[model samples]
Target: MRITGIRATPVAVPYRSPEVWAFGRRRGQVSVLIEVDTDDGVTGLGEAAAYPSADIVLAVLRGLEPLVLGEDPFAVERLVRRIELVGTWHHVKATSPAIAAVEMACWDILGKVCGQPLVNLFGGRFRERVECFYYVARAEPDDVAAEARLATKAGFGTCYLKVGSDDPRTDIERVAALRDGAGPDARLRIDANEAWSPGTAVRLIRELERFDLELMEQPVSGRNLDEMAYVRGRVGVPILANEASWTRYDQLAVIKAGAADVLSVDNQMDGGLANLKRAAGLCEAAGLPVVKHSLGELGVALAAAVHVIASTPNFRYANQAYGALLADDVTSGFGGGLESYADGCMEVPSGPGLGVALDPDRVARYAELYRTEGASFSFGDPQALARAHALPKL
Candidate 1:
C-alpha cells in the first residue's frame, strides 16, 4: 500500500528521577512521536528522543513528507535512498531519526501485512530472552553500593556505574563498593562518557582493573582512534565504543585501529533497523559483539532493539537504561513490564511487527504536555511547502 500521510507530535516525559550520566543531569525527556498512515488503512508508530526540543524531528517529518507521500510503504530501501539524496548536500542531522521513524513504521506495516513478527521477518530468534543491565547513574560510593545491592536484589544480572564524576580515587572507591555490593555474580560495567583523556584513561583503567570490571565504555573520546587504540592496549578490560561507532564506516575504522573490543549500537544515532542490521553484520563478521546503547528511548525503540538483538547471531552483551525506567510509555502492547527480567535476562516480544501497540490516549496526554507552539511544518515557510509539493518526483 502507498503511504498517504505522515504526522509528528512533540512530547516531553518527566523522568522518574533525575538521570545524571556522564553527559549531564536530565530532568525530563524531550521526544517526538511519528505516525505513518498508508492507503490500506494501516498505521505505524515510532518515537524519537530529540533532547532540548523536537524541532529537528518536525523538520525531518516535513522534509520527508513530499518524498514519502504516495510511495509504497513496503519500499523501505527506496524511501531511505530518497531521504539520503535530499539530505546529502546539507548534511541534515534529522536524516537518521526521520528515516528511523519511517523504517519502524514500515516494519509495523510489514508485520501486519505478512502476519508475521518483526523478529521472524529479520531472520529468526537466536535467543529466547535478552539480557539487560541497569545504570546506577551518578551516586556516591555508599549510595552506589546501596543501588547496586538493590539491583542485585531486584534480580538484575548486570549493573553499570557512571564514572568520571571527579577524582579517579573516588571513582575507584565507588567501583570497589559496587563490586563488593554486587558480589561476584553480577556483571559490572563503567561508562566515562568520553570524560577521560588518553593518559587519564590508562591510569584509571589500570587502577580500576583490581575491581574486576567487565568493560569501560567510551573511556576516551571517539574522535581520536589512535588514542583509543593506545588506551585499549594499556587497559586489561574491554573498551566499548558508544558514540564513536555510528555507521559501517565508523565501525570499520574502530575495528581496523583496534580502538575497541566491543561496539555499542544506538538505533537512534545509527540510522534505523536496516542500518543497525548492516552494522551488526559487519560487527559479527569482525567477531565483535553488539550491545545496545541507551538514548533514553521508550518502549517502541526498546522493542525494536530487542528484536534486533534477538535476531543477531553474535550479540553477547546486554544493554543498560531500559525496562521500567520511563515513567510512562505508549508502546507497551508487546509485554511492557520489568517483571519480564529474570536471572538478568529479558524475553523478546513474540507478537507481530515490533509486537507493540501505541496508546492513543497516552499519546494525546504527552502531546498536550510537551507540545511546542510553532508552525507544524519545518520545511521552510508555507511558501516552501507549496513549492515542494509542486515539484515532480524523480
Candidate 2:
C-alpha cells in the first residue's frame, strides 16, 4: 500500500525523578509519536525521542514528509536512502530520530502486512527476551545507594550509574554507596559522558576498580580515538564506547582504533531499526559486543528496540532503557516503569508489527501534558544554564 499521510503528536511524560548527568538534567522524556497512514487503511506507529529538542524533531518530520509521501510503506531502505541522500539529511546526525521514526513506522506496516512480528522479520528471535539495565540517577550517596538497592531487589542484573560530577570525590562516594547497597553480585556500570580527561579517567577508574565495574562508558572524549585507546588500555574495567560510536561509520573507526571493548548502538542516533541491526552486525563481525543506547524513550520506541535486540545475539549486555526513570507511559502493558520489566528483562512482543499499541487516554493525557509543560521536560536545566560549566571537568 502507498502512504497517504503522516500525523505527528508530541508528548511529555514525567520522570519519577530528574535524570542528572554531567551535562544537564531533564525531568522527563519528550517524544514525537508518529502515525503513518496508508491508502489501503493500514496505519503504522512510530516514536522519536525528542533528542536535542522537540522542535528540531518536528521540523525534521515536516522536511521528511515531502520525500516520503506517495511512497510504498514497505520500502524502508529506499525511503531512508531518499531521506538521507536526496533530502540531504545524511550529514546531520541530529535529524536521525525523525528519519528513524519514519523507518520504524514502515517496519511496523511491513510486519502487519506480512502477519509477523518485527523480531521474526529481523532474524527470528535469537533470544526470547531482552535485558535492560536499571538506570540509577545521579543523586546523593544515600539516595544513590537506596536506588541501587531498589534495582537489585527488583532482580535487575545490571545497575547503570552516571558518574562525572563536578567533584570527583562525590562520584566516588556515590559509587561506593551503590556498591554497598547493591551488594557483591550486582553488575555496576558507570558512564562519564565524556567528562574526564585521559589522566583523570585512568586515576578514577583505577580507584573505582574496587567496586568491579561491568563497563566504563565514554570516560574520555569520543572524538579522540587515541585518547579512548589510551584510557581503555590503562583502565582495568572494560570500556563501552558511546559518543565515539553513534553510527556504523563511527563504530568502524572505534573498531579499527581498538578503542573499546564494547560499542553502544542507537537507532535514534544513526537512522532506524535496519541501521541498528546493521550496526550490531558490524560490531559482531569485529568480535565486539554491542549494547543498545537510549536517548530517553517511552514504550513505542522501547518495543521497537526490544524486537531487534531479541532477534540479535551479540546484544549480549543489558541495554539502556528509561523504565526506571519514567513515571508513566502512553502505551498499555509495556515499558514505562520498573514494574513492566520482570527481572530487568522486557519480553519481546509476540503480536504482528511492533506488537504494542498506544492507549488513547494515556496518549491524550500526556499530549496535554506536553502542550502545557513541555519546557520542563527538556534537557536544558535552568540551574545548569545559570552556572559556568565546561566539559572535561578536570
**Pairs of colliding residues, candidate 2:** none
Top candidate, metric lDDT: 2
Per-prediction backbone clash count: 0, 0
lDDT at 347, model 1: 72
Off by over 4 Å in 2: none
RMSD of each: 8.6, 0.8
The number of the candidate with the highest TM-score is 2
Please write out the lDDT profile of model 2 over residues 114-175, one tens digit for every residue.
99999999999899989999999899999999999999999999999999988899999999
TM-score of each: 0.89, 0.99
lDDT of 1 by residue, 1-394 (tens): 8999988877665555556654346555556777789989988777776732477677767877887899887888787777677545123434566668777888878887887878888888988888888767556788888878878887887898878654577788889989988888888999887878888888889988888888899888888899899999988999999868876778889989989999987666666788788888999888898887766676777777778788887678877545544566666543234554676676777777777777778777767766552223111233323432220111
